[model samples]
Target chain A: MKITNTLLQMVKTVSITAITVLSFSAHAADDKVYRLKLAETWGPNTPILGDATKNMAKIANEMSNGRLQIRVDSANKHKAPLGIFDMVKSGQYDLGHSSSYYWKGKVPNTLYFSSMPFGMVTTEQYAWFYHGGGMELMQEVYAPHNLLSFPGGNSDIQMGGWFKKEINSIEDLQGLKMRIPGFAGEVLARVGAKPTNIAPGELYTSLERGTIDALEWVGPAFDLRMGFQKIAPYYYTAWHEPGSETQFLVNKRTWEKLPKDLQVILETSFRVAAFDMYTQALDANATSWSKMKAEYPDIKVRDFPPAVLAEMRKATDELLQEQASKDPQAQKIIESQAEYLKKSRAWTAISTKAYLDTQ
Target chain B: MKITNTLLQMVKTVSITAITVLSFSAHAADDKVYRLKLAETWGPNTPILGDATKNMAKIANEMSNGRLQIRVDSANKHKAPLGIFDMVKSGQYDLGHSSSYYWKGKVPNTLYFSSMPFGMVTTEQYAWFYHGGGMELMQEVYAPHNLLSFPGGNSDIQMGGWFKKEINSIEDLQGLKMRIPGFAGEVLARVGAKPTNIAPGELYTSLERGTIDALEWVGPAFDLRMGFQKIAPYYYTAWHEPGSETQFLVNKRTWEKLPKDLQVILETSFRVAAFDMYTQALDANATSWSKMKAEYPDIKVRDFPPAVLAEMRKATDELLQEQASKDPQAQKIIESQAEYLKKSRAWTAISTKAYLDTQ
Candidate 1:
């Protein structure tokens, strides 16, 4: 009886010790890890997009205390540049950074919000998104496709494009095959220009091989990088896309699965990234332009003729009106934007315009 | 002898067990709780500034995993609004949020960088600071005073002020007490207007009591909030300040003591806050103006007479030249800014201007 009692006590002691060890192990396991894959549209060397993505990933990782890690894969590494949207929406990738204009074929209305022909400036778009409910509207627009959207950055105003021939009037646009996208393409089509959508990687080759006659990428920073000066000498001012906003699209399922704090970290990080990218692009473009002008003097920078711009503006107004008539959501957004613009312009006319005129 | 050997082994075992337990206790003691104190100039009800401070603290706490926390104290909580700089620099608080123009008395050079009478827009200022090394130069200027600076928010453009009397010429400014700050104040003084610095919280009462003839506290947003229309009837447009940038100043010692990751988080968070606040001001101003016009139709909105604006412009040019001659650091920062502006303006003329005219 004594021996049995002693054996029973030993069993109880071992069981308690084992249970404590199991509890410790379970606590450690509760520290969850979420690994995210981010696909970027721009090349690895592009300062604004590349730096923003890298900074965002670093901040997310640090904020999560290493629990959430995002690995960015440049466009060519995972898929072609144009394939980013499909990959993220299909959940083949967790997130994607690309211009929303690139996916106009898949989501037509998305183009207006991304890069409207002469619509909004960087600050104005930021205002519309955050305060005017544009961000919520964008989410609603993208929700059908199983994606969550965030404005990653904005290239304020872009140069028109590099053309092999000078454009003197609306007639010059006939049979002109230009690489453009979104509503701008539709506007160009109205003037008899054939709009060809091509990825940045394929642009140089197409222009060089005569597959395309002209192309519009961004401003001097990106244009200089893509070596557009070599193939096309006449670089026209891109007044259509006043503020071309880039977007970051995350798979809805992946976004929903993230911890609440991680979601906040990601959103805030992207907001900062947008501001950083705008400033960087401005400075980098200035530097690149100086270099181009000094070393590549053969490249000519020109503004679009007034007559061509006048025709394009009329078409843009009609297009916007038509879009508003079709979708009440688009109508509501445009109406509110118009009201805000009217008030802002009144103030700007007296202050900003006055200053510019005097200078 | 065998018993002594066994006892010695048991003592060693007990010693190792005690040491292990004590080591863990020591580590637990080393875990610290750092409480950061923030001072802001806005009242608790101010939407963007007040809300941003609260949000920043919340984000910082969550990002630190609750190890680091921030406690924001609004204006008049512990000190007066204008006392922010001294309080922060003297270590009365770890952080401060206010317009740098408010501290022109101590740092005259800051006014040029913070907000000129008619300087860069919100986007242009962001570009200068982040990419054109304006931030680094600002840090250098503030280093001697034991502060680390970050751009906090922007009150994009400001109306001239609300006044009871009309001034048609430069001579009309003599003996008129106008509420203005920073370098603009100097220009006002040069033109014979009595420049008086008043806090936003005090502007209403001062205006009512006739302590000042005119006052400017941002645009329609904050002016409506303070009910300035009740005290001053004539709301004038085209004030000296076009875009007024606010700043976050941190105690140098406190900033240096922070972890590298926390530093990045703080800097990035402020940048986002600036973008957020600028838009919030825009949206809020629109709402506030409609309410003002409806509720108080007697309130008059008038433009700054061209005669007054012309004089102010001449004074501004003289002020710039004088400062450039006096301070080398100010000269260097201004030169870099001017050079960038020259190129940016040329680009904008061809692109942005062309688009706006056509649209």
Candidate 2:
């Protein structure tokens, strides 16, 4: 009887000790926190663009129950507005928020991920990215760089530019000094315009001083605050960058280090924030456009004439063809976009376009 | 000395017991799983609509590390496709996936939350919902019902309907029979058309047997499979229910009981899943439309003549005015939507409309 009692007491103590350890280990795993550093191309407090990163960080933290802490460093803090791709790739930053096309000079194929010249609009582009092999293609391009990129947010359709003089014909574009950049600038150059890139702060001064006769900025939401309407009366409609999508970049090493739950939280946060930004952009643009129209009353809304647009389209096609001929990957992406655009546009023509036309 | 030694041993055993109890409680709280039951309006294995709930559950489960478990029951399991509002309100289900308008008879103000005749498109409506006081208005409507409503997904631009003959004038609609439900049906009735509601499974036969002259189903993604293209040669473009947004309903008590982290995960899952459904719908529609066109080259796509459209718009405005006059809440939502639409459409006209026109 004494030996049996001793065995029972020993087993009870061991069971208690084992349960305590198991409970503590599980708590340790659940309670472990992850801190991530993100760098955005936008400056601090930039309206729609900056809001996406902030919103992402906030949601991720809350969703992870304060376990995933993200610190965002905007352009002012990082001092490298255009160097996000390299920063994230080299592990200097764990995450980045910027437009994909900004890295075209370094990785030529990154251009296709953002909006294209005269390409799909916001919904169509999103459909392409999510459902039409766009995400896969984007992954293929980023994998070699040890990074993962996601569609960060859409800026909606960009306005053509703020023009001092009307662009009535291809001849009118000749020798026109305009502050346009990226593939669009290349397209303009091909069509006989003098495409230039100027600092954002210098844009209004340049236009006012005749250093540049015209400039392309974001839509009315972002553009109105710059006081461009006072100097440039003509606000043209979109042709290039129909639906400009910003990107979220993550270093492969940083991503792999994250627990699966945190990874999912981070990605979902990116997606919701991205979609929120697009709606925010649309709402801001609408409200700003209303305010601008009420204040200015003389801001001319013009579409490039059909003939001039045809010439611009031709230039865009030639540039894409040249890129396709040089790289097989480029060819694949270009072809995919072209084919998807053809199919989606037809449906859009029948549905959205048809509805708008009837209205 | 012996009494002090006995007291010390008791203290040691008590400390061990206390530590064990604390650890187990912490583990229990952290590992607790919330299994929510969701009832969807769609039947089992429904495509775009059904995919949303599955995606939401999957993501919520992953992001919460299995803490938030959602069990979705479709119409087949519940046998209450249109009974979601009542079911969720009474706590028979914790969540529901259905369109807001399905509850219009029980709560008339719920009509404004779904698609309106001549309403804003997907992006525009989303902007209104998130930015322009739509969510607040929606909440106000649902607050009295002990439920909360959120935009579940957009079906994109719905087709007007499949017709056996072209609708060229108001006279053509007089005495016409079409299977269209909801607010659009009221608008049609005002214009002297007999609008009928038919069961989904019986729709093909109804149109085929002349029980209905025309029927407005969903877009090509969901329609082509029903073989409507072969029977209805004249497929009219969209005029009614332009962008149909489905809804997610949460029981108030259920929402209040969730821990904040799970709540965020659940809400974010709804958002991302909603957006994903839209893209999936767009891609599916584009692909299906292409296939339908290739197979049925004789299909006629037509827009209602301008005179007929004007008449329909007039009738729609009259009905909305009537509703506004009757209910103060309806008036508020109507005015808000009208004001927002007026401002946003102006921006859209200058941007999206101009781009499409140029193309």
Candidate 3:
């Protein structure tokens, strides 16, 4: 009886020990959470641009069951909206949301990732990013900087902007003062137009007071609230920044430290957030444009005259050629984009264009 | 001394029991796995369509870290390519990948979720699905049968078809023998073409042997290997199923049973898979089209004459109206689509259309 009692107690003790081991591992696995900090270029409560990060964070946290938590700090907190690239690279921020072209000053090759003067539209550019070797090229550019980059979101097709005067011919564009920026400004300068950059806060005042002859803002979704329609008489269609895609920047160390599942969750969240933002922008643009037209009946939507567009196109081509000559990498990216664009545009013309025209 | 030893033994026993209980809950939390079965309409080893299911399943699995596992069964295994709705609704499968229109015979309201004849293109339709009350409408239509529907991958813009001869006018469509299925076939029949459905296995032989004079197939990505270009001299642009969206059908019970984290993981996978498929389809179409043009230099690309297109459009409208008059739900959906299309298309015209035209 004594041996039997001892044997039962021993069995009970062993079972309890096994349960403790299993419980400890499970608890560690379930309760351990990785908290990350994200820096974004957009200010707090910025509409489409800011929404991408919030949506991404929400989805990521939900998908990871609170294991992957991200804290987003907007421009107000960071005080360096344009420093996302450096911050993410140096691991000061785990991730960043910004447009790639902003880094072009430091890295000239970063220019091609965002929309060019006349580049692929959103869908075509997305295809290029995923299937047309654009992502590989993007990695080639960012990897050396200790960062990994993903296509963040698209702002849709940006309008050429509002012009106070109707441009009828190539001569009409001569010495025209416009608030344009970046490489597009260079293209316009070559075409005998005075391209200038004004701060966003001053764009409306500049256009209204004739401090600038015209200013190009984002399309109707963004432009409507700016009240540009009440001032500028002509809203020209887009030519520059046709499909401006933003970027999600991650520090290489941050990404490497994540669990494989968290990595997938993070990436998929980014993808959906990007797509949702594009759709949101589309709906917003459609709704806002309709509202603008209804409220402001005199808003004139015009395409730049063909002669002026031709000159701008010529200048764009010359600028691209000059840039290509300067860097082998630039030459490669330009050639790839041109080839992909030609092929995709042909299909686009026949499919989307055909359907629209027939309707 | 004897009382002290008894007290120590009691304490050891209680501590061991407490540790065991804690371990049990932790193990339960960390080790519990939820496995789901998915049914797809496509056959085993099918091309792009099958790949979508695989991609979705893979992402879901990776994101869940094996906690949520999904097994995919293609048509070959399920033996019910057209019975996805029944299977998923009965909970025979937790999820399904199929086009919503396939269930139209059983539920007419389901047809509107897929692409409509002469309707919005991919991006426009996607905008409608997400922002234009399409998801709610889809849920209304599907919720009755214990199912939830999502905008699955798009087939991009399907070509009108390869033709044995050019369709120059309405007269040319009279008595034309073609193999086209679904609502588009009805539109063609109303316009005087004899539309017939052929088994997929026999499609190539039927087209080759003149059993069908012309046939509507998917775009170049899908049609390239069928060698249709070798046989058909005329390739016409699209007028039907402008952007054919597939669907992901989920059993309500299955969805409800999932943890919140797993639910988000599944939905996000569906979203990314859908987006990835579109990009892939675009890339494949562009590549295949370039190849087809290179190899089949003699193939002529044409659009049905304006008069003929107008007739087909009228037929589509009439058919839709007839369906709407028969059912209140149909009317509501049709009106929603029409209103959204009008608003969205106006923006599309000024933005995407104008840009394409100028280029």
Candidate 4:
């Protein structure tokens, strides 16, 4: 009876064309629910990285007033932690939450979107992405793949790693067995370090039982849980993947089907969620590092000596140059990043760097 | 006839109670539009700061599907640039965009929400606000005044100032007639510098004609337009207002009146807009500094000598101690910030600082 009466009132107001047009357009959209399924690379209940997807989904749902409902499927459910890009592109999922660099095997240009060894820091990279033609370049990369990409979240600066002993000079890194993966491993290999990839579950035991002398996991916020500091007392500072950014992917068909308002809501959600993750990582790292210091008084925070760092940086440049020479698109991105880094770093040196140094 | 048929169809499907309830609630919300008014301390089109409000309003409108409309009035329309706190409190405006320190005179504790002397940098402060109880302390200060406050935006790091001569020592600062304002000015005065506030319009002339020997304005992004570099050859690095954060002010009553969805939309818009402004500031500063350097190749980037910086830090500590002695609330906030700064900076030193220094 309530439904009937409401519809009857709508019929009575039909003589007012303005009201009728407004009612149909707005009501039709509001009444239909958009239920999207998102597949994430992380397992369910993972910390900061997992939190970003949930935060974004909740914000979008609330802002849309239930018009947009998103179901997040973690890797536990999807059973393909590294398959996010393919799943979203193939429409197996409407959206995916993962880091862009994971797809580098399939798309070499994808490597630039994530953090680079000795690249710009978080804020500098964000400035590049939003204002320095990064977003447009990113779209160009993804558009051909039936996908669209947005920055999902940042994990803040990833520390260089944990070492059982201090690294005093370039000689210390020679033939050092370390569990370091991805592009950074290649850089380490060039620097005479024996870089090896080990599964996350076996990392602690491998380091403890002498299978590996060192391992480079995430920073304190994540590393604390693995008890790496318990066995490895020397915690090195960040160099590789200084400001690693994760990405959100959407199937082009899914995005195109969304109403303009929902599209805006989804995009805004990704941005805020990405930013929030960064702060969360900062806070968590601080809290965790404080706790780690109290429990492990002998823990040494080390920086790779200048000579070793110089070698690593040189290798990173050579690797990037090789990629640039192979592809025009890669060259464009590499040059853009290099030019931007130069300008932004100059300002940062006189601003943030000076302030930190003063006090 | 179409509406009549729809009514008949609804009557036929009346047995489904769940569908009827969902439809009624969704349609009712869709039909209503909420209009809000905002007053900003900035003049119209005031670059990064002004862009925050427009971006926020646009995001909220689109995310809410045009159900929420915000009308923004700049200082010109309101004729009360400094009256945002009062206007929002009295319901003259539903929202406001201004810096928290502006209301320090009216509410002393409000000063802590904005940047502080020798305090946390941008991401550090954000970590404090969202995770380290900053929001709660901020709310406690505003609740009594019938207002709610959120971090509006960050202006990145503010450069110390532009100087006509080098500040070589603590002796160089004595009797220095400089245009620096707010708490920073107080710190300068303690060190025997004559710190005075000048109207923005007359600042370039004041400095050029030696009305003031050195003047601190915003960084290159803003100072370039005033051509400060053309006159002041020495551009000092930051010593004060390291990371200045602006704020979003909402009247408690207006906040309560908003629908749950609109409220979330408004808050999320503030967060995203606030973060975007920080990035925008970084980009603009980088671009502007590049331009300024190109035009004036001799612009010297100076840092206050260590002795001078040490004295300024001492002054800031003493002043803060005085505030804490007078009010327990002030004491609480000051201590919280101090403690958080310690923990966060410890992490930062090993993370961001380490990375920057090594590179």
Native contacts present in each candidate (fraction):
0.34, 0.73, 0.63, 0.74
* For candidate 1, the TM-score of chain A alone relative to the native chain A: 0.83
The DockQ of predicted model 1 stands at 0.25
User: What DockQ, between 0 and 1, does each candidate earn?
Assistant: 0.25, 0.44, 0.41, 0.51
RMSD of each: 8.3, 6.9, 7.0, 4.0
Clash numbers, per candidate: 5, 0, 0, 0
By the DockQ metric, which is better: model 2 or model 4?
Answer: 4
lDDT of 2 by residue, A190-265 (tens): 9999999999999999999999999999999999999999999999999999999999999999999888888999
Candidate 2's displacement at residue B209, Å, is 1.5
lDDT of 2 by residue, B190-261 (tens): 999999999898999999999999999999999998999889899999988778899899999999998888
Clashing pairs in 2: none
lDDT for predicted candidate 3 compared with the true structure:
0.87
* Residue pairs with backbone overlap in model 3: none
Query: Residue B299 CA error for candidate 4 (Å)?
Result: 1.2
Off by over 4 Å in 2: A1-17, A20-27, B1-28
Q: Which regions of candidate 4 fall more than 4 Å away from where they truly are? A: A1-23, B1-26
Every candidate's lDDT = 0.74, 0.90, 0.87, 0.90
Across A1-359, the per-residue lDDT of candidate 3 in tens digits comes to: 11233333443455445445443333234334678999999999999999999999999988877778899999999999999999998889999999999998999999999998878999999999999999999999899999999999999999998999998997877888999988998998998889999989998888888888988889999999999988888989989988999989999998988878889999998899999999989989998888988999898889988888899999999989998999999999999999999999989988888878888
The count of residue-pair clashes in candidate 3 stands at 0
Give the candidate number with the greatest DockQ: 4
